[model samples]
Target: MALPENYDYFTREQWRNFHGKNQLNTVTGDELAQIAALNDRISLTDVQEIYVPLRHLIHVYLRRYHQLVEDKADFRGETVAPTPFLIGISGSVAVGKSTTARLLQLLLSRSLPNQKVQLITTDGFLYPNAELNRRGIMARKGFPESYDMEHLLTFLDQVKSYQPGIKVPRYSHQVYDVLPDSYDVIDRPDILIVEGINVLQLPTNQQIYVSDYFDFSIYVDAKAALVEEWYLQRFGVLLDTALQDPLNYYYPYAIGDRQAAFTMARQVWQDVNLKNLREYILPTRNRADLILHKTEHHVIDKIGLRKY
Candidate 1:
């Protein structure tokens, strides 16, 4: 199970061996089994092999963070401030980043009852459709340029400052636009999980990078071929279901011939998603605090934790 010397991340067998020795008391086998039953998307084997270990690792990190705060306060002779632990989750489209984010939020919250966990998607910071159309980057919706980086950074900075009742703008996928007056408030949570496709990518300038605000970051990694297949599958499912809704943003796409719809989805993946992943997302893998490397079946085969 030992990984190759040159490999920075764990292999599947290595992770299993590691987990065998450092099991946490927080979540039990029964609880994990129960949770697995709630979602058929991931198998029990994946949950035990990947997510259980991940949950334990996150708990360890949180424990260490609290200790560091205490140590710093004692050394500096000042009261320790309550700072939010920001964790960024980034991955390519259809790589299951959303699922990972949601699961982490659930696991982390259950690990410590007193700690508040908030999950925020970067979609809300995307520029309105009008702006994207005007900029002639409508086809580049998920690209880095499509987001309001300045506003996103500003919001993160305010969160770091422990600002009270901070409001975050909302984006509607149904309308594919930012809601003008709608917002959500972050009421000073202990941890914030910021999930997005390009969160790890550095800004061209120093002022507005999401990584600047992160306490820890994770990148979900898989081969481009696997992700492309998943993307196509998801598109097919959406075409069969959600696209049929009259109010669905992608209604027009759903009405197209199945073969035509599949072709269009592939083109979008190749031209836009894959391009952004290569130029922006994948390049930032080195910046992550941890990397979850997945197999062809979307099971996390190993974890790569950055050395201090």
Candidate 2:
């Protein structure tokens, strides 16, 4: 199949076939069991095709990074210093980027013996909902301007510098806001996975894209139609569960009729999510170091690796 500009092609069947042939050989039974334990919610097929290769690529990058540091130390006649590997993972809302980020952190930590791995979501850097309302961008909550980009960049710089116990502000989904006086400290780690919806996008001024700080990046890809369905399904699940909490910002959504709630969710996807994906997210696919293309079932069907 001919792919359009900046796109790569792969069939769903090919991805399944690869998993069938390679799954058993890639990891020991004990290791596979551990991966299954970490990913109890995801299917075994997803674990084999998507998570396995994703973990392998991250391991390869980690190894290469250590080698480079050692080589630099030898050439400069200086002591070796440990540096954190920053990895960016971006995808649309409800595209499972959070789960992927968590899984990668778990797998990578386990892959290395006695190494610390940190996972930080860019959601924490979003402007408070009140701030979004004041800016008249409440409807554009997930857009780039809704984020505290300068602070996020500063945090990344701190991580790069291997600062000791850097405190990061925390955002709460239940309140749809960054909490007051809520912060977590990230002691230096061997790997840091920064996950978000638009982490790879270049700023309007073209000064510094979030991808600039990444040692490696992964873009999770799926058809727009599939993403729409997943978004609605996720909304339904949240409405039945999280949104039911009285303190939840989305509690009102849970009280609505099921069909009405679904409709509202779809409209949000069309007007907000889809618009951002087309205008900002999709355009950055070409900038990824690796792309994980998923099928309708949310299983990765193929991997597109950029020529390094």
Candidate 3:
């Protein structure tokens, strides 16, 4: 596939050089293990080469955002309100967006020790499995229509308005459903990182997009085939972990014939994930402020910074 025309792409080596002299080495091996997603690989070297420079860039953006807010407040003769800098991270399934979000959250928190940095996934905004089944779209679970975009938009609006104690619905991968009556509270944060496959999507019939609230947005990119391989690898890991818990969503597949399980996984990957990626996710790649392009084994080999 051809790269987008709107970005100035760089090799990982070149991208590593972009980090100024003020890079901090706060993340250790133990921390990386906790931050990484299942079956995801991220070395400290990768952190120093890729993420550190990215952190510096975010610092630059955050500084400018604060200045803009202060200038606007001065011009209007009003006090500057607590508006959190919002960062959106989007990618196809198994592309390691959660890892990126968590790592950035840690980096930003350490760098700005006095500021409160929070990370939330759009999985929480997904409609319950019961609702999807009732709507007869269970097969299209990850599709745009399966999500409650209105609720997500409302939450983003509230966060941007500096609303305190806002509740976000919780979703669980163990049961593959939105937990009933469970929520995560968002108390006024200084920086918020929202990560999900749908973060950059433009839903039909909606006047406003989720991206509209993002001060900085990233899209994780990889070839569909590579993503499929990673997805299946992750499935294997899930099966191994789920075997100990009967209530796990993959319990049945875990206890079933291994070959048959992989066969079904491939089918689902092609029908559901690949379809969603080609139609919805990939189209939004150019919409992000930056793109992290990955190669084999989840290695981020290239970085694409938007020209505008």
TM per candidate? 0.88, 0.86, 0.98
Ordered from best to worst lDDT, the candidate numbers read 3, 1, 2
Per-residue lDDT of candidate 1, residues 1-308 (tens digit): 22223336777677765542354434455654454311114655565567667777777788898899889998999999988989999988888887778777876887667899998889888888889999998988988889888888888988888888888888876666888989888878899999998788766565556797887888888889988988888776676665658777667788868888888888998999999988888888777888888777677777888875
Name the 10 consecutive residues with the lowest summed lDDT in model 1.
Answer: 32-41
**Deviation in Å, model 2, residue 173 alpha carbon:** 2.1
Q: Which candidate is the best by TM-score?
A: 3
| lDDT, each prediction | 0.79, 0.77, 0.94
Instruction: Please say which candidate is ahead in lDDT: 1 or 2.
Output: 1
lDDT score, residue 180, model 2? 83
- Return the lDDT, model 1, position 60: 77
Q: Name the best candidate (by lDDT).
A: 3
lDDT (Cα, tens digit) per residue for candidate 3, span 156-244: 99999999999999989988999999999989999999999999988779988899999999999999999999999999999999999
- The parts of candidate 1 lying over 4 Å away from their true place are 1-7, 19-40
Q: Which ten residues in a row have the lowest lDDT in candidate 3?
A: 16-25
**RMSD of candidate 3 to the true fold?**
0.9
Estimate candidate 1's alpha-carbon lDDT, on a 0 to 1 scale: 0.79
Estimate the Cα RMSD of every predicted model relative to the unseen true structure: 3.8, 3.9, 0.9
